[model samples]
Target: MNAAGFNPSERHPDLEMLDGYWSDGNQARLPINGVPECFIDLDPSHGTLTLSVPADGPEPDLARFRSIELATYTDGGDVWWEIRIQVDDSLHEAYSLLTRIADLVQLENQAVAVATYQALEAYRLLLASRGGMSDEQQTGLYGELLVLEHLLRTLSPELIVPAWMGPAKEEHDVALPDVHYEVKSTKGEHRRHMISGTQQLEPLRGVPLWLVSIQLTPTTPDAGRSLIDLVAVVRGLSGHRLPRVNELLVSAGWRDRDADLYDAHLTLRSKPRAYLIDLSFPALTDARIAQVVPSASLVRDVSYRVDVTQLDFAGPPSPMDAFVEIPEEKTE
Candidate 1:
C-alpha cells in the first residue's frame, strides 16, 4: 500500500488471499528477487499488471512484446508503471498469466545485460483468438502436445525451443537454432496431410526441418484417451516451466476447465513417421513457384495436401540427438 493512497483500479483475479484487496484496496503486493515488493501489484478492478519500475526503467523497445501497453501513474517519489491487457476469466489461468510476466521481470533482473522479457508469451495469450476451434484443430493440438511430450522425454530440456508454443504463424511448428519441426496429425489412413502455406515445408539451405506425421483414429469411450489426459501429461512433464507451456496451450485455444468440451478420444494409428526436409524432399518454394506459376502473386496463396504414405523417412541429420540436430554435409 502506498503511504499516500492505494486507489488502484481493481479487476485482476486471484487476489483474495492478499489482504486489503477485499473492501479497501484493489491492489496486492508480491515480492520477487531484485524487483521490490512494492514493484509488483495487480489492479483487480481492471485486470492490469500494476508494477513500480526501478530508477533504470523497462525495456525501451517495447514493440516486440505486443498487446501490453505501458501506462504511468504518479505517486510521491515513486515512478509507477502498469502493464495493461485484457485477461481471460478463469482464476487459475489468470494467475498463470500474471506469473509469466513476473517471471520475465525476474529473468531480466538476473540477466542484467540481456532482455529476456522479449519472450512475451503473455501477448500470445492476449492476441490468441477466442474463436471456437473445430474438431480437427483440437485433434491436431493434441497431436502436437504428444510429440512435445516425446521430445521433452527424449531430449535435454535446453534443446527444445520455447517459442515453438507461440503463435502458429511461424513457418515450422517447433524450431531451434539449426533445426525445426513441422507436426501434422491426421485421421486419414494414407498418411495424407494438409500443408497450410507454401513455406510450411519449404527446406532451408543450412537448417534441417523435419515433418512428423501422427495418424490418430477415433476410439470408443472405453478405449481411447481424451485431450485432458494429454494436458495432464504435458503439465507433469513441463515441471517448473508449466506456466510457459500453459500460456502456449491457452494461446492455442485450450482452457484447462473446458478440457471436457474436447472429449474426442483417439488411438494412434501407427508410430509417428518423421521426414527430414532435404533438397530431395518434395515441396514448392518461392523460386520454384515463380518459375511455374504465371504470376508470383497468384502463387502466394498456394496450399495443398501431400500424401506422404510412400515418402521415405530421411531420418535425422545426425543419429546422436535425433530430436534436434542439424544435418551434417554429406561427403563427396
Candidate 2:
C-alpha cells in the first residue's frame, strides 16, 4: 500500500492539465474534529475530489473550500501526512469577488460627484430667474444663498433651505435651529441704521444668519437695472404711457442730454443709480449699530441675517442673462 504518504511532488499524467498543484504521495484517510467520517472519490483525470460524505456534516454553513486545507496519506500511516493539496481555484475566486466590490465603490463615488454638480447648476439657474437685482444688496444675498444650498445638498439631503418664507412678514414661522437665514443688503457708501422688530425677529434668532453687503457704481456699464428702477419701469409702461424719459436719465445721474442717448441702448426704459454700501454689522454678533457699521465713505448700510453662505453671482449669460436662443429646424 505505498505508505510514503500523499506525495504532491509526483505529477499525475492526466491531472497535469487541471492547472493546480497536486499531492505526490498516496491518498490518506483522516478525520476532522467537526466533520463526519466518509469516503471520497479522487479523480486524477479531472483533478477533483468527489466527497462520498453524507450531508450531515455541520449543516454546510461553514463548508467552503477555501476555509479548509487538505492533505493526503495511505494505510492510516503518518508517511503521507507531509503532502498538501493546492486550492488555487478557490483562491482565484475569492480575489475576483474582492475586485468586483472595489469597482462598485468607485462607480458609486463617481455618480455622486456628477449628481452634486448637476444639482448646483440647476439651482443656480433657478435663482437667477427668480432673483432680481433691482435691489443689488438683496440680489447679491440671494446669489450667495443659492451657492451655499448647493454645497449643503451634496453633503446631506436633510440640510435644506425652504424656497419661500411666505410674505416678508412671516419669516419667523419658518426658522429652524441650524437652518434659518435672513439676508439684508444695501448700496451706497454710508451705513444706515437697520431696526429689527417682531416682523424680522424670528428669522434672526439663534440660527446661523449671515449678513451680506454689496458696493455698486451707478454708471458702470455692467450694472443691471436696480429693483427701484424695475418697479418704476413696470409702473410707467404698464399703461399705454411711455416711461418718463427725464426721470430715467436723472436717476442714472446723467447731466448731459448728449449722454442721454445712452438710455436708448438700454432695453429697460429706466435704470436705477448704483450706490456703494459698506456692510458694517452682522446683527447677531453685535447689539449696537456703532459696533457693526463703520464711519466710512460711500457705504449704504443694510442688515439681515441668514444661515447659508454665498455661493454664486447672478449676471448676464449666467442663468440670469435674459436672452434665449431658438434653434432653427431643418426643412425638407
Candidate 3:
C-alpha cells in the first residue's frame, strides 16, 4: 500500500502492548524507536505522541501550531508535550501528523519547540490549498523550488524561506539581502513570461531586481521530476527547518494530501537565467506608461507579455548558484 493507505491502527504490532498499559491506571507509553525522548501512547479510543522534556526547558509555542490540541503537562518534575489525536475515524491523518512531528523532534535537541513549529507550519501550508493545486500552479511552484534548491547550496533553509516571498504575494518571488528576484516558468521556446501587473516588475528603492526565466519541457514521468518529487527533495534538505519550508509551499498552493494529483512531470529546458531588470529591460512600468501616454493614470490592472529571446541582457546562463548572502546582510 502507498503511504496514505498504511493504517497504523490495524497494522502496528505494538498497539496491543499499549493497550495493556492503558487498561491500568498508568499512562501507557511506547517509545518511538530512533527518536530521542519520544514515545507513543494509544488505547482503542485515542492515540498520542508524547515528547518528554525537562520542566525548565523551553516550552513549545502552542499558538504556533494550532490545528491539534497539543497539551503540556508536568509529571514527576518532567514536562511532557502531548500530541493527541482521535484515531477512531481519522487514523490516517493522525498518524501522518504524529509522524511529521516526530520527524522534526527526532532531528533537534529542542524537541517540543521544533515539533510545535513543524506541526504549525504543516497545517498552515495544508490549509492554504482549499483544494488541489492546478497543473499550471504546480508548474510554477516547480520552477520556484528549483531556485530554492540552488539557494540551499550555500544558504540555510531558515534564510531561504523568508527570502521566498512569492507565496506571500509579494512583488518579487525572492528577496535576498542584496537583491530581489521575480521567477517565471514557461513551456514556450522563447524567453517569454506573463507579467501580472505594473507593480510586479517595479524594483525597490535601492535593491536590484532581476527577472528569472525558467524553461520547462513536458516529459514522461520517468524522464523528469514530478512536482511531488521536487517538493520532497527540498523538504529533505530543509532539516529541522521543515516547517518554514512547508509555510512557503502552502502559500504557493501545494497540499500534501493531493500529491497524487500532481503527477505531471517536467524537465528543465535549460538552467534558469536571471536578467537584471535595468532601464534597458523590456517592461511596462507605471512610471513608463505615465511618461509615454500622459493619460495612462486612468488605466488599472495593466499586464502584458515580454519575450527576451533577442534582448542583450547581462546575466550568466546559469545564474542561481552564483547568488549567495550572509545572514547579517539580510534586511527586515
lDDT per residue for candidate 1 within 21-85, as digits (tens), equals: 52444666665444532245656666554444442444434444433456666678765555554
lDDT of 3 at 314: 49
Per-prediction RMSD in angstroms? 15.9, 29.4, 16.6
Candidate 2 lDDT score relative to the true structure: 0.30
At residue 56, give the lDDT of candidate 1: 40
- Model 3 clash pairs are none
Model 3 segments beyond 4 Å from truth?
Answer: 1-131, 316-332
Between prediction 1 and prediction 3, the one with superior lDDT is 3
User: lDDT tens string, model 2, 231-272?
Assistant: 344334323322333332233232231232233111221221
Could you tell me the TM-score of candidate 2?
0.22
What is candidate 1's CA lDDT for residue 304?
86
lDDT order of candidates, top first: 3, 1, 2
Could you give me the TM-score of model 3 versus the true structure?
0.57
